[model samples]
Target: MSKNKVHYLKKLEIISKINTQGLTVRSVSHDYNISVSTIKDWLRLYDSFGISGLVPGTSIKYPNEIKMKAIEDILVNHLSKADVLKKYKITQNSVLNHWIKRYNNDKTLKQRGVGVRKMNKGRITTFIERIAIVKEIIASDFNYQALSEQSGVSYQQSYSWTQKYKAHGEQGLQDRRGKSRSSDQQLTETEQLKIENKALKAKNELLEIENQLAKKLLEFEKDVTRSL
Candidate 1:
């Protein structure tokens, strides 16, 4: 809270203690008076971006194709979040979370630009406004287009925010554009089933939504033709 940025060496020192000494992140947080999340971010950034990831205000741009493929891996190929992080060399967990947010809600992967300030796709919205929009979207059974149009926010922003709120509550909406590679753990059968089921459910929902929209479009076209 006191320092806006911690030096890379200092960040490295803290991370080293955890990695080498096996010190708990909590202990390091208490000793350094830094939040546990901040320390965790540094550890991940170090793993992914090395020293540069630990640097304050470091912005890494991910290409759109890379983002889309990563999303497909997560949603369709059933890759774990941690695995996707390593595979893509994504700088922060938050970056992937942001991408997942868009994918889950909209059922589409939109192109994302790079940079800390301008990376997000939509126009600016306040925390309070996001909460309101998210709540409305949930109430409408996640009708992102309706809520986005009503709120004058882009559909992508509405979908992204709503997805986060649904998954992590209000805290998820906070711009956490924040990463690490630990040893990969083997999944049990039950865990494997859960991952597959989740992906299947997402795919099913997407298809259902698309079908309903297509039907409505066809009906509208028919009505227009008859009236003319």
Candidate 2:
């Protein structure tokens, strides 16, 4: 197993004990020599996604349907952020906040095509250069493609960077391709947990049904053999 999966299993073990053994988070933290906050976060994840949420090294993606449902629950149905989060198994208000912004802006949940353009001559642009290019685009009223030609970068790159910079300031320009942030990073922990938890629960349920069917099939085979 991957190290992340192993670590998840370990956390799952501790969380299971907390639930089954009726132990408090503090007590479990002391026993496992883990931080109380970490243990609490693990418990929250377990509660949200079961064992699958505890699985490490996997990035979860939410579908447009789920995103729309969450948005409707908040905007149309008038649910509070906490209520929406709990209902949808989301971990952060920021996710809903972002969704609301997109909805208001008439943007779709789908990523724009701006990021798909080929890089300029396959050369990676520096952060400083990217920031400068994005600023110029913004100053030019978000004429990203025009500015991209001048900056020797992809229009997609310029537009995407400008969007990120607009939403998150300069820090968003930092490349986060391979690194995994804690639940609180760009997306809230709860938001990610919800997606993973839902997927894991569905998988677990399917596996349970399959196991039951296998047991029945084995019993039927034994019975036929005996009769024959």
Candidate 3:
């Protein structure tokens, strides 16, 4: 037992002796080197419920391990909130509130901070120049890390820029922060439609080439069969 526990047990034993032997509180406190008020308090507890009441009243609010385990099981196993609460000895509302708060904070953190550097005209222009250099390096069959080193951009940033460029084209290179709808002067509707149509036509031509190659292969097989 801890020193505190030993002290508590000694106090209880002293109080028990005073109660049974009818020893005075002042005399017992002086002999035991304990306070008189402390002896009085112990005797009061002893009188109230005998030996059990002499033990310290537990005021510590220990968290329920079963409830914590239940929460863990619910999260790890994807169990329903009601089932988790029932298994863990916690209220349904407590479990729901805890998870909802956790999910909301996680989502808020994602939306609030992305850890990317703030963009400006200087940064945007530098990024555009680097992007051009990266494209040139890629055409020459340089790897992503080599392009990153050549462009003075991290590999992850270079990869992210490549994806953004693919998704939004040249406009993606422009700084978007603090910009409004008025700043967005993209290609006209007719121009966008024309570009899309041209891309579709290119895709169709590639597919046609592949189909012709397949037919040529079949014809070559037929000629070989005749020769055999």
Candidate 4:
């Protein structure tokens, strides 16, 4: 939930404690203040493939053998989607669902790459487009999945854009390629100027919107007072 990466060892330890200590998923989740879904995912991965399945990071490539085995376990053994997910150590049930769909349509078990392929995977998004998508996501009550489906962007992309927008406003959505601000030394004059300009532009836009909203609220209040 914090967006900070949890080490796989920590996840494995939590799952082990749940099993060896006979703790319920809800109890473990409440004790650690982690979401129940997160804990259950860890348990499923560990149970399905042992320690190897609990590896961290999203860029992991599942071998064709593993994919086929998962399919067989589900189709031939008549396992439920959840059961196959737990038995195959899949991180997302959607991955299995996609495989099932592909098998049904083509009778093949080929695994597609992660994320939406509409714009060549990590698409180069314009600042205006990113801002619009972020705004639409906010209008949809932060439904990342719905935003991804409707906008043809991956759910991870939608979520990441929203997070960047929240953290740094519109400028955060900018494609700051080849710019690293984590260095100890001062930034170059050009880099500093670019950053300052972006920040100023974003701030000015935010202030203008805030001023408009304030004026509208004041007018509405005055109308209400007059009517009363």
Candidate 5:
């Protein structure tokens, strides 16, 4: 599996959650900290090719004529992107977007080669870098794929770090295995403040979720009272 790519098995799990468990794309996105667009892409791909569609580098290489036709259906016939994807079985919008850009620019329709694309392997990162990437993931609305590419780490790495940060605070991001207690316990004032701040953020987020649930519960109770 490529470092930057999400594994097909994980994609299948997400698809199952949405399809079999009756979860909405947005809810799955929130729970998994992935982008809604990315989830939608996976759903469309799975719809077209089942588990195989979710596999990285399995997309079909369309002829130039097909590309032009798909683009025309969108640009001239006013088809929705989703509709076009279904019609053509294209797995990703990014590919069609590229074709659209070229067609609009009056470029010639040329068939591109098909095959797996080469991506750089994920690189190791320090503790500080992990913290920065996790912060960026939160700031970007939990777009883990984008952060993974930007941070030169695997999607798994970015997602795991964020999960740990949420579940265990700053200490979760540290790789203290095989280290002595003295070094692990040592922390500068600023780093200590960061740990405190991250914990508070996690607590505040929990509070926000609880507050929303409480409001919904109150609404339900009011409806029950009115009915009685």
Candidate 6:
């Protein structure tokens, strides 16, 4: 198991907490605290995957004890990581880090921490979903109208997604459309009309060129008829 200074400090706290309560690493880590391997795994996760891995909480995607237990059970039963991910909906990265944390320096496996807890904020769920959408938009370079049509979210919601992305970087884009912008971001009808007018003028100029070419063809046909 790998860990950083912060994670090591957290482990010391877990150790102290358990010691004050007079518990062993096996019982304490499994019940009162996350496993030592889990701590080291989180540190490793931080080292390799960065902060996203160490974020404390559960995902809306998977919120069942039986399921979490199934993960540990599979690992204990000696099933592969790929197999665990297939049975459960979690990503391979998540499963790997979780198991690494669960086993840490301890060789034995335990089910004491199977108690499932709910994630705290409803807004976080929304924020994560919004971030996923914004990431898609940035990757594709597709704007709001296209996103609205494809995603079946409202036009206003799509624009809100972009604004949230532009303002908040990745974290701001997470699970939220964010607060409303000032009126200055809104375009007036007059401004919209001017834009439309410019487009129409450009189209009309293209049509005029096509019409002049047709006239030249007609003149050429008349000359051919007279020559014949």
**On residues 31-128, what C-alpha lDDT tens digit does candidate 6 reach at each position?**
64465655434434333323333434423233333344555556557776645554544433565566557644333323222322212111222444
lDDT of 5 by residue, 1-228 (tens): 222377767777888999999999999898878888788878888777665576677656664436756877887789998899889898678888988777556423322111111132567777767876787678655655555666788656877899999999767888878964446445678975775576467557756876996686567546644643
Q: Give the per-residue lDDT digits (tens) of candidate 3, residues 1-228.
A: 232354545766687677788888888877877777556656554454344434454221213224334445665578876555444334234444565455346653222112322121122334335446445434433344444555565545655666777788756755567965343445566755554565456456656866996686567546644643
Model 6 stretches astray by more than 4 angstroms: 1-182
TM-score of each: 0.38, 0.35, 0.25, 0.36, 0.42, 0.22
Best model number under TM-score: 5
Badly placed stretches (over 4 Å) of model 3 are: 1-162, 165-183
Clashes of 3: 0
lDDT of 2 by residue, 1-228 (tens): 222334765876787788888999888878777787667656665676555455553334554446666777776688877667667776455666877787677533323222233434324875556666665665554555445656787656776787898899867877678965433334345644554465456456656866996686567546644643
In model 4, the Cα lDDT at residue 118 comes to 34
| Candidate 5 whole-model C-alpha lDDT, 0 to 1 | 0.70
lDDT of 6 at 124: 23
Ten-residue segment with the worst summed lDDT in candidate 1? 111-120
Best by lDDT: 5
Ranking by lDDT: 5, 1, 4, 2, 3, 6
Alpha-carbon RMSD, candidate 5: 17.8
* Clashing residue pairs in candidate 4 (N, C-alpha, C atoms within 3 angstroms): none
For every candidate, C-alpha RMSD to the true structure in Å: 23.9, 21.1, 29.0, 18.3, 17.8, 27.3
CA-lDDT, candidates in order: 0.67, 0.61, 0.51, 0.64, 0.70, 0.48
Ranking by TM-score: 5, 1, 4, 2, 3, 6
TM-score of 1: 0.38
Clashes of 5: 0
Give the clashing residue pairs of candidate 5, or none.
Answer: none
lDDT of candidate 1 over 42-87, digit per residue (tens):
7766777665566567787765557766777887789988778878
